[model samples]
Target: MNSVLIIDDDRSVRSLLRSILQKKGFKTRECADGTSGLEETVGYRPDIVLLDLLLPDMHGLEVLDKLQKAPVTRAIPVIVLTGSTDQENRLSALRSGAVDYIEKPFVAEEVTLRVTTQLRIHDLIKSLQTAVQGLEDDLKAAGTIQRALVPSEVPAGIEDEIRWIYLPSSSVGGDIFDIIPLNDHSYLVYVLDVSGHGVNAALISVMVHRFIEDFRSSRPGDREPFSLKEFMRSLDRNFQFERFETYMTATCVIADLQKGEIEVSNAGNPFPLLLERKYTQRLDRDNNGAIGFGMVKGSTSVHKISEETRLFLFTDGIVDVRTCEGTRLGEKTIADLAESTRHMELDDAFSKYQALLGESLPGAQTSFEDDVTFVAIQF
Candidate 1:
C-alpha cells in the first residue's frame, strides 16, 4: 500500500484531507505543525508528502527546505498545500523540490489523481536508479578480474627487467598483455588490442587472453622455439571470420633465451622497438591489418639482442595520438622517444612519452585517452 504524509496547522483542514485520503485507499499520517511533520516524514518514510504553506510555528517553505536537505527525507515526493494564492510560496516550494502544488480548496478527486501521478513517477525513477547501480557494480567486478589477468612478473628462467603499463579509459578496456613461458627457454610476450571500449570490447580481450594462455599450455616446455609465422597463423585461424571481426590486432613476440634470439609476427599492431644506450632498431617494413575475416599474411621478422637491450612492445593507442594541427604522432616520433629514453628507467620512459603526446596536441588528450597496454622487457 502507498503511504501519504499530510502536514497542516489547521485542525479542520487536516481532518478533511485525512478523510479524502483514506477514501482513496491511501494509508495517511498527519502532523499539525512543521516540526512534527518533518519528524514524521523522516521517521515514517512515506512515499509522498502533502505540505501546508501556512503552519502555526513555521512556514511551509521552511518545512520543505528541512525535508529536502535531509538524506532520509530528501527523496519523498512533496505536494505543497496552500490556502493563500501566493505565487511566491508556490514558486519557492517547487524550487525547493516539491513535485506539485494543491490549493487549500483542493477537490478530493484532484488530490487523489495528483498524488497517484507523483507516486507512479517516483517508482519509475527508483527502478532506473536501481538498474544503473547494478550495471556499475558488474563493470567494477569485471575490471577487477581483467586487472588480475594482466601479466606482472616475468616468465621463469628469464631474469629480464620487465616493465609494463596498462591504463584503461573506463572501468575496463580492450588492451591486454600477457607473458606465457612455452618451456624454460622460450616465452611468448603478446599484446592484443580490440578496437573499441566498454564491456563488449573488454569481454573480447579477455577471451583472446584465455585463448593465448591455452596455446601456451598446449606446447611442450622443451619444444623447439615456437615458429613466429606459425603462431600468427594459429591466431588467425582460431579467431576465424565466422566468429570474431577483423578489428582485433596483436603483436606476438617469441623470445628464445637459449639462442639469444627474438622473432615477432604482427597481426595488425605497433612494431616492436629495440632500444639501447647506443642505437634503436625498429622492426618490420609492412603494416598489417587486424586479424578478422581476412588474414593479411602479416610480416614476420627476427632479431638478435644483447644483454644491454631493452625491448618495447605496445598497443598503437600510445603512439596514434594527434596534435592540434592534425599531425599524428607517427612511428618516427615514438621511435626517437624510445631511443632517447633508452638509458632511463622503464617507468619514467613510458610517462615521458605519454606526457609529450598530451603537450603536443589539443584534442589529442581525449582522442588518445584510449586503453594503453605495453610491455618493456630488458636484458
Candidate 2:
C-alpha cells in the first residue's frame, strides 16, 4: 500500500488525519513536532508527507528544508497544512517546495480528494521516471554493441600502426568506424557520418555499421580482389537513400602495407590527409555528393607514399568544432593542425590534436559540437 506521513503538533488533528487515511487504505505514520516529523520522514521514506506549518520546536519550513536536503526523503511529495487560506501563505508554501496546500478545519471530502490527487501525481511521476530510465538503459546497451563492432586495434598480421578516436555528441551517436584486415599486405578502414544526432541518427548509423560488418565478414571479393569502387557501389545500392529522407556521407580507405599505397572512395566527405615530415596535403577529391545520391565509379583517389607517411581520416565533426575565439575550425585548419603534428608519433599526434581542440574551446570535450571521430594510420 502507498504510505503517508502526517506531521502536526496538534494531537486531535493527527488522530483525525490518521483515521481518515486508514479508512482510505493508506499506510500512515504520525509525528507531533517538526524535529520528530523530520526523523519519521527520513525513517519511513513515505510516498507523501502531510506537513503542518505551525510547530512548537523548529519552524515547519525548517522541517521541509531538512526533508529536501536529505537524498532519501527529498523526492517525497509534500502537502502543506496551513491555518489560513490567504494567498500569501499559499504562495509561501508553494515557494518552499510543497506540492499542494491544505487549509486546516478541513472538509472531509476535500481532504480525501486532495490526498488522492497528490498520491496520483506522485505515481504518475514515478512511472515516467521509470520509463525514461528504461530508455537510457537501452541506449547504453546499444552504444556498447556499436563500440564492440568498431575495432579498437587493426586485425592481426596487418603490419602498420593504427590509432583512432570516437567522441560521440551524446550518450549514443551517429559516428561509426572499423578496420578489417584483408591480407598480410592490405587492410580496410572506413569513417562514416550521418547528417544529424540523437536516436534516429544513431539507429541509422548502427544499420550502416552492421551492413559493413556483414560485408567484411563475408570476405568481399577475397578471391576476385574486391575493388573499392565496387564496395562503395554495393553500399550505395544496399542503403538506397532515395527512399529515406536522411542523408549520410562516408569514406573508405584501403591501405596496402607491402606496396605503401592508398586508395580511397568517398561520398561528399572530407579528403584524407597525407602527413609527412615537412608538409601535409589532402589526397584526391570526389565530385559526387553524399552516399545516398547515386555516386558511382572513378570517384577514387590514389596516393603512393614516398617516405614515412601518416594518413589522417576523419569525419567533419573534428573540423566543424567552433572555438571560443568564434572561429569554426574548418578543413583547412584541421590540415594545418595535422601538419604541425608531423614531429610526433601518430598516436601522440592525433590525441594531442583532439586535446587542443577541446582546450581551445571551453566545454568542447564534455559537450561536443558534434560526433568527433578520426582514424590515423602510420606507414
Prediction RMSDs, each to the true structure? 3.1, 2.3
lDDT per model vs. reference? 0.81, 0.81
Where in model 2 is the C-alpha error above 4 Å? 85-90, 220-222
Question: On a 0 to 1 TM-score scale, where does candidate 1 land against the true structure?
Answer: 0.89
* lDDT of each residue in 125-202, candidate 2, tens digit only: 999999999999998887787677778667888767888878888877888888877766788888999878877788
How many steric clashes between backbone atoms does each model show? 2, 0
TM-scores of the candidates in the order shown = 0.89, 0.92
Give lDDT tens digits, candidate 1, residues 1-379: 8999899888898899889989989999999999999888888999999999888989888899998899998889999987566888898889989999988687989899999999999999999999999999999999999989986577567776787767776888988988877776777888888888889889988988888777666666666445667667677777775675536888888887788888777777887788766878776565456777455575677778778778888888777666556677777787888887877777788788667755764643443557877678876
Model 1 segments beyond 4 Å from truth? 155-157, 321-333, 351-369
Model 1 alpha-carbon miss at residue 48, Å: 1.0
Least accurate 10 contiguous residues by lDDT in model 1: 360-369
What's the true lDDT of residue 15 in model 2? 91
